[model samples]
Target: MRLSAKRHFGIALVVAGALMCLAGAALYVMPGPGFPVLALGLAAVVIGLLLLAALRRE
Candidate 1:
């Protein structure tokens, strides 16, 4: 099946967000702006998922 560019972008965002969240989780134990990273990751994930949802509706 062919995927639309919008869908591809949404998937990329989801993947990047997931990776960021993973990195943040790792940083949490290392001590160094952990909270900020975690927050940013969470925000990215939320935005990405929202984008995905929007794209799916289209």
Candidate 2:
């Protein structure tokens, strides 16, 4: 079945969040700040919730 634009966007956000988390995890073995990337991924998830709410209002 086909998904709506909002649904697709939400899925994309989820994928992005996952990728961010993976990158952050990888960073732990590297040299940068892993915690901040992990926090940003969590923030992206929060933004996804907001996006859903806004979509509902439309």
Candidate 3:
């Protein structure tokens, strides 16, 4: 079956969030990449949340 946009978006959000959590833990060892990873993950989560909200109304 084909995946809906919401599903894909949600998946991305969760994956990104997971990555962010992981990166946060890694910050103690590597601050350079972890900070950027966290930012990207947060952005993904925000975008996904917006997409999910939009989907709900449609």
Candidate 4:
């Protein structure tokens, strides 16, 4: 099946968010600020999920 651009973008957001969360976790173990990154990542993931769900419903 072929995926549309919107789907690709949504997937990209999810993946990028996951990577950001991972980086944030790693930072938390080190000596940097991690909360902001983690929050942004969570937001990105949520937005992506919502977008995907909305698209699926259409």
lDDT (CA) per prediction: 0.78, 0.77, 0.71, 0.88
Worst 10 residues of 2 by lDDT: 1-10
Q: Estimate each model's TM-score.
A: 0.79, 0.64, 0.61, 0.89
Q: Among these predicted structures, which one has the highest TM-score?
A: 4
- Candidate 4 local lDDT, residue 58: 72
Ranking of candidates on lDDT, top first: 4, 1, 2, 3
Error of model 2, residue 44, in angstroms: 1.9
> Model 4 compared with the native: what TM-score?
0.89
- Candidate 3 lDDT, 1-58, residue by residue in tens: 2348667867788777777867765883675556767666677777777777766686
- Candidate 1 local lDDT, 6-51, one digit each (tens): 7777778778878888888888888776777778878877887898
Best first by TM-score, ranked:
4, 1, 2, 3
| Cα error of candidate 2 at position 35, Å | 1.3
Q: Compute the lDDT of residue 32 as modeled in candidate 2.
A: 88
Instruction: Give a tens-digit lDDT track for model 2, residues 1-58.
Output: 2337876787678778878888988896799899889878877777777776777776
lDDT digits (tens) for residues 4-24 of candidate 4: 888988999999999999988
TM-score of candidate 3 on Cα atoms, chains taken together: 0.61
Off by over 4 Å in 4: 1-3
